[model samples]
Target: MRRLALPLAACLLLAGCAPTVSLTPAPQATAVGCASLIVGIRGIETIGDAQRRQTDAQGTAAWGTPASVTLYCGVETPEASALPCTTQSGVDWLLSESGDERIATTYGRAPGVQLITTRDASVNDALETLSGAVATSTRGTDRRCLADPGASATPSAIP
Candidate 1:
């Protein structure tokens, strides 16, 4: 019994000296909205390789960033709106960004000519910070058009 008590005491002392470890949880993800534009200019073939340079220059001057020139998703037809994505020079462009990862494209169309409409951090973020505000279906409503936010223009009018 005496020997057992000494060993137990030593074990207890050793156990008390052992360090306790802990871990901290990482932060949650964030979201955002950023502008993106897709335009298909006519006479593109005639422009030839110059189209590449011209598109790049135009995008840099307009978006002040590396614009990815690609195909047009617009279905051009007289049946379309007056300033449809096909006819208009630009559209309301926005994409979402969460920390290092790009969340997704917020607004369907481009963000229009003016990249930064407001000095708001989201606008300046270049990469947007989004939330449940996006990722939802949006009907053709001028109310939510960042290109011309709340303009007194009609659906057929390009504000």
Candidate 2:
């Protein structure tokens, strides 16, 4: 009985240490550009100080113990919106806020990449960290976020 109890305790401890993150795959997970996007995502080393968490979804990734940041590739590209758009590392992202969560989706890239972060700082870090992957993996279009929508007749890409 003593031997069995020791082994059970060890098993429980090992189980608790398993690093797995629960994430829902994006609706367009199997979309045309997702294969390359997945490759790019897998190559990411780190986001801020957050360690990468293993995700069950094919085109999704999560980081940090409680998953402060998550990325889903293959989301539909967003159209022009009132949401604030920002460019980081040459990648344009459409930003939105809900409760405590901040969401950013790639604006001009097809099979868009969406990031959800719990903290504002994490969102910026995430965008900067993931920009290289996104730029390399996805196709870019002429569309861009305008600073003043009605002011410019020419659609200038945000620098």
- Predicted candidate 1 versus true structure: per-residue lDDT over 1-159, tens digit per residue: 998999999988875542322212112111111112222222222211112212222222112112222221221112223232211112333333334322112233222122221111223232221111122211222423333444423222311
Best by TM-score: 2
What ranges in model 1 sit over 4 Å off?
1-40, 46-68, 72-90, 95-140, 143-159
RMSD of each: 22.0, 6.6
Which segments of model 2 are wrong by more than 4 Å? Answer: 1-16, 148-159
Question: Residue 106 lDDT in model 2?
Answer: 88
Candidate 1: 10-residue stretch with minimal lDDT: 26-35
lDDT of candidate 1 vs native?
A: 0.26
| Per-residue lDDT value at 54 in model 2 | 80
Please give each candidate's TM-score: 0.18, 0.78
In the range 71-107, model 2's lDDT, one tens digit per residue, is 9988887667776777877777887777878888888
